[model samples]
Target: RKLPGAAGAADEGAADAIRELEEQLEQATQSLRAREEESKAAEKRGQALNSKLRRAQAALAQARAEARRHAEAGAHQDQELRDQVASLSSELDRARRKLKRAGKRHEEDKADKAARKELQEDFERRGTELYKMNDKLREAVERADLLGKALAMQADEVEQLRKHVGEADEWRAKCDRLSMAEAAAAVG
Candidate 1:
């Protein structure tokens, strides 16, 4: 009497665990999908960033060219001012001094341009490293997707086994009850 009920409870517990595993497998699959989407989005971002970086490099080159032209114009202006100072002798030595300062500023601008070029090279190197990192991340996501599929399959197998066990337990209980009923009827 009570033995059959105890057996049924044990079977129910096993069935419940199998159900829980199935639910967990579903959640894992959803998470794997999310990771795959994130990987794709990361790839898109890297591409966009690379495109923008290329445009920025082109703009920097244009700016360097404009700066070179401006420096050349300033040098021509300095020469003209120097000739005027020579003719005017002492009236505008200050103008000649200003022209010298402008030349020094052009030297500083050359140094700045060199530094900017170095920075651009560094940025390109860093971008390449970032792309490699993203590749590894995408690979990790793919592996996780495979693992989720395997886990889902295993969970399904467990669920099927649980169902079969539950059916067998039910049939055993029914047979026991039927035999007991028949024995009691014969005794009566």
Candidate 2:
């Protein structure tokens, strides 16, 4: 009876050891599967970050290109505006000088106005005197025309008187001849 009891106790101890070894193997398998899942998640996160970095770099390059083009255009417009301002400033200066000269001339003309007025009045007075002289000369020419007509009539009267004198002389000579003839007849 004692030998059988000892043999039975030994068999029970060996069964307990086999059960403990199986539990240990199961725990190790569960731990290895959880580590594999964590590694896969880390790889996916890295891939997503790389894609975002590429997109950001492309956006930055595009923005730089646009900025450069705007700066160049702005510079060109600024230069054009500056040139226009310079041209307008020069024109304004020229206009101002011309106005100043004109103002000086106007002041000089105003100062001489009294002398100019006196000369104008004298010229008008002389013109009136000359007009009266011209009227007198016209009247003298009319009187000369009348006198010339009277002289022509006097010359015609003188010519008629000379013809009458010649006729009288002829008659006187005939009378003298007749008287002499009569005296000779009486003597005979």
Worst 10 residues of 2 by lDDT: 179-188
82-178: candidate 2 lDDT, tens digit per residue: 5655665565456556756778756555544544565456556655654655555455455445545554554455455445545544544554454
lDDT of 2: 0.52
lDDT of 1: 0.55
Q: Which residue pairs come into collision in candidate 1?
A: none
lDDT of 2 at 152: 56
Off by over 4 Å in 1: 1-102, 185-188
RMSD of 1: 22.5
lDDT digits (tens) for residues 41-70 of candidate 1 = 555555555555555555555555555555
- Best lDDT goes to which candidate? 1
Per-model TM-score versus the true fold: 0.40, 0.39
| Distance from true location, Cα of 15 in model 2, Å | 99
